[model samples]
Target: MMEHSVIFPDHRKVCALGQGTWKMGKSALREADEIDALRAGIELGMSVVDTAEMYGNEEMVGAAIRGLRDRVFLVTKVLPGNASRTGTKAACERSLNRLKTDYVDLFLLHWGGPHPIEDTVASMIELQQEGKIKAWGVSNMDVPEMERFYAVPGGVSCAANQILYNLAHRGVEYDLLPWCRERHLPVMAYSPADEGRLSRNPVLMEIAQKHEATPVQIALAWILRCPGMIAIPKAGSVTHVQENYRSLSIRLTAEDVDLLDGAFPPPVRKVHLDSW
Candidate 1:
């Protein structure tokens, strides 16, 4: 639904609305359905697909986006445990193979694991040189931690930061969001619907009534309304993905925002990051 693009340091345009794939491969019972959901979303213009080695579903994602690889902006992560200079390269190679692609549009450090940020970042740089990943970033970061992340040599090249952010969990607004804003770095908000916990809010329901849309749309609209944001809500069915895609066209008015703000107020003080 987003016509404009968020340019990475390498000058590639990143789509704003995406599909998150967490707990996607943890079960085999629904593999085909999950792949259908992904392919459906991509067909509907939600081309950015975010996954991680930690999610255990790169193979499924690779299958779903098989023929549509170039149309989608693929993102995957290496676990912190695998962040060593050698480990990062190896892990990325494995991910690339599993993804059935030569390279990923964006690659990330899944979290702040035991590895030194320098070693991990250096490895990411190497992978970029070898064209394994076009750009790299970190996930689940706080403002202070991200500051320390960039302080490392070549750390300033981080293209984006993925974190748990949603209407119900607005903790990043207190600091992290503004930090990325100043630097023009896109903040990829995983679990943008609070893992599907936001659709039942009474206020969201009331607003949805006014817009003639579902509460899910109102919840996602709030996140996309913000500047420099990319919201990825996972879908396991084609219907769900289509619903998310339709949210892109739901533009909230100032009054709609004010009412929702009072119901689910923004954080005035810092709160801890909420994760899956």
Candidate 2:
């Protein structure tokens, strides 16, 4: 099995595997199951919960971690549209009210937007000072954007960078991942399994058979193998969540890594970061 935790530049630690709530709380019929799935994942030590105001599910997350908040390392995001200094503060208040928590462990700018990065960075610093958030970061930032982010005041305090990374999308591995690693910033990978597409790959299937695991688990294990990388995969049911948790126990041999790398070649040149 691989290591289970990643440390930020400032030395904060979080689970390598986390729960993603991209389209959560969108269906009343599946709400109970989704909440149960998140709780089950938390019980299994995947306590880094990732959601956002954009996902429209902070209230559901609030309900799932209701009595168990202290056990969670909660993470959420502010929409890019509301990333101005004042807008950021207003967004945090709304997120806090929806999450039913006094403070979010980490808050992120959903993505680069019209607002100046300096303004958002200033706002994030202020929020930390007020104890409204423990730390702040960004999502969907490529290397150029990240460089620009670092150029601004207070940008060095960015704790992590969340991105779309998986076996299928290794473009970030070329430059973005290394750039963050150089700065000691952890990367929180959203859609790490490519929304289950990797589950059908014949190569992953062959490898999973050798390990007596599912192809999706192999995909997740590949992501977990990297240092300073975190994967947040959405599981809408308890069984799915348990399957994802089991990936942490998988140990892919060197040959297995080679086979996966051969099947899904890493990028040799920088490419645009994929966001969904």
Candidate 3:
């Protein structure tokens, strides 16, 4: 099996193919299936589990990792509306309660909020000091926003930047990706499959046939091609998560790369960072 992992600035290593719970926890009917899928991923070497309070699924994640917490690299986020110095801490506590864990391996600011970055940074640092979170990061930030974030005191301590990145969403490749790479900050690619849009592409299907893999796997493998990057695709069923885990073994050749590049052309000028 091919193992892929991302090392945070703080040197904490997690699986490059993490489990995403963005749309998980909404339906009670799929609760057992969701939990089983998460556990199955862990069993297959995907130990990084990303969740958020806004997803309203922390409790579900909590249940999934029960008695298996130490085996997982857990991450959750603080909502931007609750990103104040005091509100950040309060929000984290609520997340912890929902997660049933004392501390998250990583905590993130969901996005740029009304609160000052300085205040959020201070609160994040305080949370680290209090052992509520091991590290902090941001999500949905573009290059300019990242620059502003780094400008704040204590902001440089950010461990990673989670963004909307995938084969179809290559806008970040224009500048944001290089910017993060220059600083050696890991970029977590969410919605890596583009919500299954890439699964039916004729070009991708050709590449998948060559590799004997699914188009979705080829798409994900394309994102994993870069160093200092992680791809989080939500899989709500055992079979789906198994297929995602299998994507790790795919090694796209240079020809495959050229083919994909020609199909989903990389960004030319500086395009605005895309988000959901």
Candidate 4:
């Protein structure tokens, strides 16, 4: 198996793949499936769980990771509108309550909003000091927006930048990914399969056939191959979760990557950050 880990600036070696609970709470009928799939991911060594207060599924994630709290690296996001010092603090508390955890391993700003980044980062810092979050970061921030945050006091400490990244959306590679690399900040790819849309791509299908895996697995393995990057691909069932977990073993060669490049070429120009 091709085992991999994303070593963050803090020296934490987290699993490259994680569980994303974005739409896992869509219906109460599937809560059992959601919970089992999440726990199954952890059991399969995909121990990073990324959820968001805005996702409205923290409780389900909480239930999923119930007895396995100590084994999971928990992450959750606060909405951008709640980026204020007070709002950020309150939102994190609410998330913690929902997650049934005392502290979140990572707390993120879902995206840039009307609130000031400095104030928001400051609030995040305070939260860190308060032991509410192990680390803090932003989501969907382009290089320019990140530069603005870097100007703030203690902004250089931002741990990770979660963004829309996948085979289809390689825009971040133009600048943001490299910029984050220069700063030693890990970039987390949310919706690494383009929210499952990449599964139908013939190019990926060809590559998947070479590896005897699904197109989604090939796309995810590609994301995991990047330096200082991690991907959280949501799985609605245990089978899907296992498939994602197995993607770590699907090694892509230079030829494979080149082939993918032809289909989903790297971005040469700056593309605005695509947020949910």
Top model by lDDT, which number? 2
- Ten residues in sequence with the least summed lDDT for candidate 3: 1-10
Lowest summed lDDT window (length 10), candidate 1 = 1-10
Q: What is the lDDT of residue 217 in candidate 2?
A: 94
CA shift of 67, model 2, Å: 0.6
Model 4, range 1-276, lDDT digits (tens) per residue?
325788776887888898898888889899899899999999888888999988899988999999999889899999988888799999999999999999999999898898888789889999999999999988888988899988999899899999999988888888888899998899899999998899999999999998999999999999988878889999989999989988898889999999999999998898877767
Query: On a 0 to 100 scale, what is the lDDT of residue 33 in model 3?
Result: 97
Each prediction's whole-model lDDT (CA): 0.87, 0.92, 0.91, 0.90
Q: Per-residue lDDT of 1-276 in model 3, one digit per residue for the tens?
A: 435778888877877998999989889999999999999998887888999989989999999999889988898998999999899999999999998999999999999989999999999999999999999999999988999989999989998899999888899898998999999999899999899999989989999999899999998898887899988999999999999988998999999999888988999999987899
Put down candidate 1 lDDT per residue, 1-276, tens digits, no spaces: 456346666777756788999888667888899999999888877878999998888999999999999889999999989999899999999999999999998999988888889999999999899988989999998888799989999899898999988777787888889989999888888888777778888988998998888898888888887877888989999999888877878889999989977987899998887766
What is the TM-score of candidate 1?
0.96
RMSD to true structure for each model, in Å: 1.3, 1.1, 0.9, 1.2
Which lDDT value does model 3 have at 113? 89
- Tens digit of lDDT per residue, candidate 2, span 133-216? 999999999999999989999899999899999999999988899899998888999998899899999999999999999999
Name the lDDT of candidate 4: 0.90
Rank the candidate models, highest lDDT first: 2, 3, 4, 1
By how many angstroms RMSD does model 2 differ from the true structure?
Answer: 1.1
- Order of candidate numbers by TM-score, starting with the best: 3, 2, 4, 1
